[model samples]
Target: MTSFLEKWSARKSDKPKAGMRSAVDAFRVRVAEQKAYLAEFESDGAGFNKWRSTWFQRAPGGFGVTIGRDSIDAGQGLSYVVVETTAQVAEFLDDLAQHADNDVSFQKALEQNRLRRAALLNSAKAKVKAPAAKAATRKPATVKATETSQVSGEASVEKPKRGRKPKA
Candidate 1:
């Protein structure tokens, strides 16, 4: 029979990953025109901040975020990304650029941004070693006996009592 401890361990392992981090080069995209994610990052996916546009709720309140990593310091084409939590990723893909629909755009932007990151990661998997799934183990089943013979020469069994209506 499967032990409680084994079941507990399996459940624990099934919990969402906690150490994922992602990184990716930053790029600019118009929120109104962006069809994919501006960035992507799952704290425990492949690597932290790996995708130029993505979101991760590192802080409290589980507020999702879109990410933008840029080398704006050197101005060598200014590498950076913009992030929005919730479904507002696409709206905020590039902060510097102007978009009138900040509120809605922000929400949509966040979602699109996440999707973009996911696509990139999928592509990366095709090129690299996609992580392997953890294997789960099950214990052997136990046999269930239905009948027994008594030492006194009688079938030592009692029939279950019935006909009790539950009170409302």
Candidate 2:
């Protein structure tokens, strides 16, 4: 038998099926359109450059937020963070702390943040109802076993058989 690597290598030279090629091309087009839309959105004053703050500032205290490559100080009550060098990260954390101290919204957001341990525990546990218990609670299926016996010309009861009946 050909190894997986060998098979894969052999298949690599062959062109994808027409349907698959069209699907991939369609996906690429969609991705490009999305990228363009995002670019235009960002370029506008209401976009990422402005922290999308205008959209959020519909209320007196409302604010929009956007994360930067270097920092997590998005204007909203939340931010996405990226860790780089240790010193830079330390400095960023210090700045974030200072910002949080001064910003009531950020402080509130931080207050609402779930602890890592609690989040992990919550994620690890699934809350699915037991199917077996539900099945046990259901009424047992009633069997219709009565059939006319051709030989005796009388009705007889037998457990219903599953699947196709054998032809005599």
For each candidate in turn, the TM-score is 0.22, 0.26
Estimate, for each residue in 26-51, the C-alpha lDDT of model 1 and write its tens digit. Answer: 22233322323323342343554433
CA RMSD per model (angstroms): 21.9, 16.4
Candidate 1 CA-lDDT value: 0.40
What TM-score does model 2 achieve against the real structure? 0.26
lDDT value, residue 55 of candidate 2? 18
- Clash tally for model 2: 0
Q: Largest lDDT belongs to which candidate?
A: 2
Candidate 2: regions farther than 4 A off: 1-84, 112-126, 130-136, 139-168
Name the Cα RMSD for model 1.
21.9
| Residue lDDT tens for model 2, 97-150 | 456557666544433332443466676553334566686788665422222234
